[model samples]
Target: MPEAYWLYEDGIGEARATLIDDDRILAARIELPGRLRVGTVARARLTEFQLATLDTGEQVMLDRRPPGVTLGSAITVEVVREAIPEPGRAKRARGRMTDATPATGPNLLARITATGVPVRTLRAHEPDLLEQAGWSEVLDEALFGEIAFAGGALRMSPTPAMTLFDVDGDGPLDVLAERAAVAVAHAIRRHGIGGSIGVDFPSVTGKATRQAVAAAIDAHLALPFERTAVNGFGFMQIVRPRPRASLPELLRDDLAAASTRAALRQIERVPATAPNRHRLSGPVGACLDAHPDWLDELVRRTGRTPIFNA
Candidate 1:
């Protein structure tokens, strides 16, 4: 289990993300953040569409269509495996002897090999989910909304626990809110970001505007997730139960080094591994400690750990 951020420079972009393995990222999709400048930095929690093989072959990265995005009737299944050759006896060299293991199997064996699922297989599996998820009108609405020309980018970070949508805007807060709220909801399905989600809409003070924005949030999130009131701080919170990081994050991190840098800001949530369970890390933890009562709250919320580090 690898943890920490990776930075990409030179020909590649630099961003923070959770490097899951040598080649996989557990953070947001950095490459797709709209209108990249020569040196713009973005942080994200990646989403992925994956097909894992029983033989531990290649993990296919698919475009994670939002829940109500699209689903054709037919689906295809792709399988990749190496033909295992029958076991052969190894010849000993005059100076060296090497033990040979049987190379016979149904899939390829290599120090490194990659495989993927067929596209048709992926397409066929969407309808039943659509039916179960009650997605008819939702799909129609999204299709209609997608045609308008507005320039801004929104990305989703879907964890099993929560979804955090970071909206990068080139427009006013009003425009960003309307478009982004919808986009976040769409992304919820696309990336299947569920659980408790905190949508960070650009802060606004106008009462009517807030109300309108709240209504938009409710309308967009009605079906897939239960909408909670926008908190006092204007955070539109919703909950949609989901699995894990979706597709885009998986690929960018796997293919390049940009994903790791996108995650350093969030690593504090994981809690440091330390010997003192009573301690906490980061500003939030420090604040809690300053106030004895809040410190008690922290203890109540998270069980004591033997070790802690900032």
Candidate 2:
């Protein structure tokens, strides 16, 4: 374990946070605009409830049903888990009924600062410390869920139930399984994935190999998680506290938003001394036009109005 600090960068429609350790990204988080963040205290209406499934519609689940805060009651709840959007639907944002003062939670920068860890803020004029650290490659992995390691690769799929890591590669599956286990742990931290996680090793892998693979995950990942032993099927499930959407879920659930923000980041990265006025086309351009404030921000940064193609 090396001394780790956070890198914070402001982008269009999002705040990016990366945990840098040993000159690479150890973990990362993306704070999308309009998200109901964790640790926020707000007044919410208790619309519905069930045994374990809550349908608050506000996408907030109270930590526990308060004694007097029944359905249809207006109450204050401190957010526990932010809303998570998956392929077809979204998960509720979870909160606990609270009597604390109502206030918006700390934003990404604030949250990172509260960690008592050193934070390096990247400004437009500052050298692109983030890009130099393979930020785009991490984003691509989040979008595609494909991670290639030296000996193997892991394909992570975030379903409504759990995020699945299917290990793939050639030759000596048991060896590959162990190697893939390491990669899986790396991907888990790098992509900020939590909640239920399933890792699938080659089925034919021996029992001893399965245990070894499980051990690999334990050795690589930090503690504070509960995991089931690798079964005969080579499947192991690990559960972590999921407070918000993982990097892949944020990028994959809605590609239009992802593309829009990515385009803005690209445009923002242009040299401050570059020529005035730029041309943007297709969906990216259209998405910008759809959000005038974002476009105005771009204009402010680049000092030129954009030319839209079509």
**lDDT per model vs. reference:** 0.37, 0.81
Looking at candidate 2, the ten consecutive residues that score lowest on lDDT are: 50-59
Best-fitting candidate, scored by TM-score: 2
Off by over 4 Å in 1: 1-149, 158-161, 243-245, 248-310
Error of 1 at 137 (Å): 24
lDDT of 1 by residue, 21-91 (tens): 23332222222221112111122111222222112222222223323323331122222221111114211
In terms of lDDT, the poorest run of 10 residues in model 1 is: 89-98
Task: Estimate the TM-score for candidate 1.
Answer: 0.33
TM-score of 2: 0.90
